[model samples]
Target chain A: MPLEAPVEVMLAASAGNVLVWVVWVVAALALLSSGIAVVLFTNPFYSALSLIGNLASLAVLYLLLSGEFVAGAQVIVYAGAIVIMFVFVLAYLGGRADAPWAGGPTLQAAAAVVAAAAIALEVIVVIALAAGDQLSDTAEVTGAFGSPAEIGDLFLSDHLLAFEATSIVLLVAAVGGVILGSAMPQRSKAGAD
Target chain B: MLGPGIAAYLILSVVLFATGAFGVLIRRSPLIILLALELMLNAGNLALIAFSRQLGNGDGQIFALTVMVVAAAEAVLGLGLIVAVSRKRVELDVDKLTTLSG
Candidate 1:
């Protein structure tokens, strides 16, 4: 009996791979719980830490989705640089963890919740409809899917304008930050003098 | 053979977005609001990458990268503004920022 590749092996290899499932579950849980911690933690400092956790978990999720470059950017830009900025602001603000927060107006909170629920339900329904007859297995990931080279090519070729625009935006943001930071001290000094 | 599908990823994105929305509404601190906004942006990136994977296209990932750059810039400028506001000893609560509330 000529044995072709066994069904079990094929099933174990692709989307049904147990490792993928485990990683997905872990990453999703981390993404969610850390997000909750960000919102619930009273201390803004703690919230920043939680946001870092959330960002890191999101990086992991990006990796699981086979987006290596995105995952790296998530770690570098978000978990590293952005979170550090948040911490600096927290520290600059005296790291006051005990700020009194009499949670915002109740009506606004209820409105937000309702809006969020409605949006969530709409998204779930759309996803369900979209995926109803189209639950395909994970695509065969080629070597070039999320590689830096592929992304760079895309940036240089198709997304050149947008890429250049982003650079300009970053430069502007930097200058604005400097201006905002410097102008304040002088004004405050003037007020004092 | 039930591996996570596009729907699963989409559901996660939706949940994350909703959490961000809830945070934006419930939290008064400008910093927390910025963090929540980051969460929402990340959610958008996640969805983009997921679709990129599903469609076997690189465009989504590229867009996600662009979004990350924008997010970083936004974070920097936002933190700067927050610092400027705090320097004046103005209350950080959003509700109390009624200087322009006509």
Candidate 2:
């Protein structure tokens, strides 16, 4: 009974527990708000804006998780490139803001819940399996979370084929994009007037 | 240590993926759907990195890199087609773009 009656010990544990709760609450709120914005906005520009905010928040989450490389990639490729492309396309293909054609608000929400459930289940299974057994001792390493040099070395070595294939894929995509983009109708000189 | 960890990262990714999936399913604009699809792919990237950290394996990071490259390529080509389609009809609405509607 004496061992369990330590006031100092309880105070320290409660402090730590409260801190964790606060952080988790904030992260959850940001993520959820962005998700709602993605749906609630009818204008495509606003939707793209919401998406950019979501990506930025996710990048912060990646950093908090000690994923420096991933955070960088999330910012550069996603926030920088992908969102910019989306904005550009929306601008280039100008149209008046019209009512969203997405039918049945209730149906959309229902489908979202089902899909979220499936993704959550898969994640739970993976985490459970991982916790049950020692898959690898790497995560336990003290300095393992943000090792960019090691990541770079592994990228050029063990994953060489994927790297090369990705380059090829990009090249083909660029060529195809150019050809297809150029083929779009040019307003005939006489028709323009 | 109330710092965020892999579990927090995972839950956030799941939420992002769900948002993207919802957008794809409900949005009638092809361009908006494409943007949402990118969001979903990004959610996958976050997971790959989280799992890579969990397993202490570099494979997840490598896979994520490949995915980014592929996503960029897809965006370029996909948008090109979208431009062509829009020019012909000035309709970004998915229902009208369908030439094969039965």
Candidate 3:
């Protein structure tokens, strides 16, 4: 009975499971396509728009990963707040589209693609050969797993130090951003001209 | 346990990260670079959450949370610099911003 338990978990099927599977596949596809759109789009504004879609799909994927609280945070923080900042900055900067790899070292672009593909291939091969079957089992979680209350408990207990550190990091980043924004010398009539 | 396993999620992560890296390497604009950087970070987040699910723990989720904060900070600073560069009426290309004494 114990020996067959793992196989049962592996092959488990149900209506809810089927729904989750469908959502996972849809989100995964959206994740990949939007990611490509972010990279391949020459228009930075459109890329920013795709970034929103990309992050939104990632949030959905997070939900499938059992990251309930983090999934919400992903939507609110990354998808909402960060992307809005990107859009605002793009607008303020009036970023006209620029061609990527425009007049650059032709070989460098090729090398970049090759190198990235090599890295992905390397990791996938390692996963497939070494730990593919063994790592397929998802850990059984408690009912309260990934809930905000549970995460907050963690923040106030086990992860208190790191939690506090993140606040400090955000504070420092805010101050640094302000300083950096004004650090440049203005040509008296810079934007006006 | 439904259909795809952790491997599927991880492979997706790898592809996302590689696409981001390729963009970063080839893109000239800082804005595009930052967007690519987000792609890379999300790839990392997806992997973290996948592992968290596989391991059935909140630790990876917390780590992912921290990563999100760091990412927000990075975006703020990067955009601030971009704004500063533009206010100076300087061309906004990372490759061209080689001089410090400008």
RMSD, one per candidate, in order: 2.9, 5.4, 4.6
Tens digit per residue, CA lDDT, model 1, B33-101: 899899899889988988888878899999999999999889889988888888778988888988988
TM-score ranking from best candidate downward: 1, 3, 2
Please provide, for model 1 over A49-71, each residue's C-alpha lDDT reduced to its tens digit, 9 standing for 90 to 100.
99988988888887777789889
Q: Worst ten-residue run, lDDT, model 1 chain A? A: A96-105
- Candidate 1: where are CA atoms >4 Å away? A1-8, A11-16, A98-105, A129-132, A135-139, A185-193
Which pairs of residues collide in model 2?
none
Sort every candidate by DockQ, greatest first.
3, 1, 2
Output the better candidate (2/3) by lDDT: 3
In order, what fnat does every candidate score?
0.75, 0.52, 0.84
lDDT of 2 by residue, B1-102 (tens): 234556666767776777777777667778777877877888888878777877767688778877888888888888898897776665777757767687
For each candidate in turn, the TM-score is 0.89, 0.78, 0.89
A1-193: candidate 3 lDDT, tens digit per residue: 6898877775665656888888988988899999999998989999999998898889888777767899899889987889999999988888788887578669888899899999899988987898788786788887688999988988889999999999999999999998987755566558656
Candidate number with greatest TM-score: 1
Superior candidate under lDDT, 1 versus 3: 3
For model 3, the superposed segments whose C-alpha errors exceed 4 Å read A1-13, A101-105, A128-130, A183-193, B100-102
The residue-level lDDT of candidate 1 at A159 comes to 93
